[model samples]
Target: MKSPEHPSAGRADVRIVAASPDAARQVADALRRRFAATEQRSYPVDDSGGTRLHLTVDTTHRPEPAQPWLVSSRSSGDARTQTDEI
Candidate 1:
C-alpha cells in the first residue's frame, strides 16, 4: 500500500487501544519517546467503555517514501489508515 503524503509521510504511525483515555495517553508518551518526531490526536466515542489512541510517526525525513516499516511495525490487532498526501 502507498503511504500518506502528510508532513509525517515517511514516519511511523502508532495507534493505541486502551480501556481508558489515561491509558492511551500513557502509551502515546511511551511511543513519542521511542520515535524522534510524533503527532497525537484523540477522538471521542459514544461507547465510553474504553478509549483508543491513534498515533502516526514519520520515520523518514523525505516527504513521502515507502511505508514498509510501518506495515511491519504495526500491531497485529490494531486498525490502520494510510492516506496519500496530507
Candidate 2:
C-alpha cells in the first residue's frame, strides 16, 4: 500500500490489503519485525475472500539486525536450532 505523506514526522499509516488472510498476516508480521507498529486491525473486504489490515508504523525505529549465522541458515534452508550450532 502506498502511504500518502503524513503531516507528522517519522510515522506513517499503512494499510495492507491481500487476497487472503494468510498473505495479509505475513506482510503485517514482516512489517512489525522491521518497524515499531501499532496493534493491527483486520477487516473483511467483501463476501469474497480478501483481507484488509491497518496499522501505523514508526519509520524512525528499526529492529536489530539478524545475527550472521541465523541469516546464513535461512538463506541455506537449514533448520538447525541455535543450540545445534554448539
Candidate 3:
C-alpha cells in the first residue's frame, strides 16, 4: 500500500455520502491517519438525513490509477473501491 500525505499537499480523494457514525468515525480516523489531515466538518442531523456522515475530502495530488475514488456517468456518480480495505 502507499503512504498518505498531508491534506495541504492534496494527496487523496475521499467522500462519504452516507455512512453510520461508527463507520464514519472509523473511516475518518483511518483517513486522518492515511491523509494526515483533520476532518473537513461534521454535518447536523437535519442536513445529514440520518445518523450518517456526508463528508468529502480532496486529495488529488496522488497519481491516478486504473480506477479512481469516484466515477461519474452523466446523470450519476458512484464509488468503486480500489483497495481490499481502508
Candidate 4:
C-alpha cells in the first residue's frame, strides 16, 4: 500500500500501547531518547480499554519507513464507535 501523507492519516498508527499513563510516558520517553525525536503524542480510548501513543520524526535526508506500525485501518471496536448490542 502507498504510504500515508501523514502518520495519523487513514488511521492513527499507535506505536505505544500502554495500560497506564506512566507506562505510556515511559515508552514515549524511551522512543524519544532512542530516536532523538522532537515529540510524542498520546490519545486515550474509551471503548478499547487502553491508551495509544505515537512518535514521529521528520527527515529529508533519510526516507521514512513504510508503515512502521501495523495499525488497523478499520475502526472495528475502537473508541471512535462501538456495537449497538451493548
Q: Candidate 3: where are CA atoms >4 Å away?
A: 1-13, 44-86
How do the residues 18-54 of candidate 1 rate in per-residue lDDT, one tens digit apiece? 8888888988876555555456677754586677667
Query: RMSD for each model, in Å, please?
Result: 19.0, 8.7, 15.8, 17.9
Put down candidate 3 lDDT per residue, 1-86, tens digits, no spaces.
Answer: 98865444544455554445566677776665434443555554555554444344555432233344455334344566658857
Q: Which wins on TM-score, candidate 2 or candidate 4? A: 2
- Pairs that collide in candidate 1 are 4-83, 5-85, 11-57, 11-58, 11-59, 12-57, 13-56, 13-57, 14-55
Which candidate tops lDDT? Answer: 2
| C-alpha root-mean-square deviation, candidate 2 | 8.7
**By descending TM-score, how would the candidates be arranged?**
2, 1, 4, 3
Residue pairs with backbone atoms closer than 3 Å in model 3 (clashes): 12-59
Query: Candidate 2 — what's its lDDT?
Result: 0.87
Residues 21-72 of candidate 4 have per-residue lDDT tens digits of: 6788887765544343546777886776677877664332333334534563
Q: Against the true structure, what is each candidate's TM-score?
A: 0.49, 0.63, 0.35, 0.44
Angstrom error of the Cα, residue 40, model 1: value is 1.3
What are the Cα lDDT values of the candidates?
Answer: 0.66, 0.87, 0.51, 0.60
Report the lDDT tens digits of candidate 2 across residue range 1-86.
Answer: 99766637998888999999999999998998899888999999998889999989889988676688866666566666787576
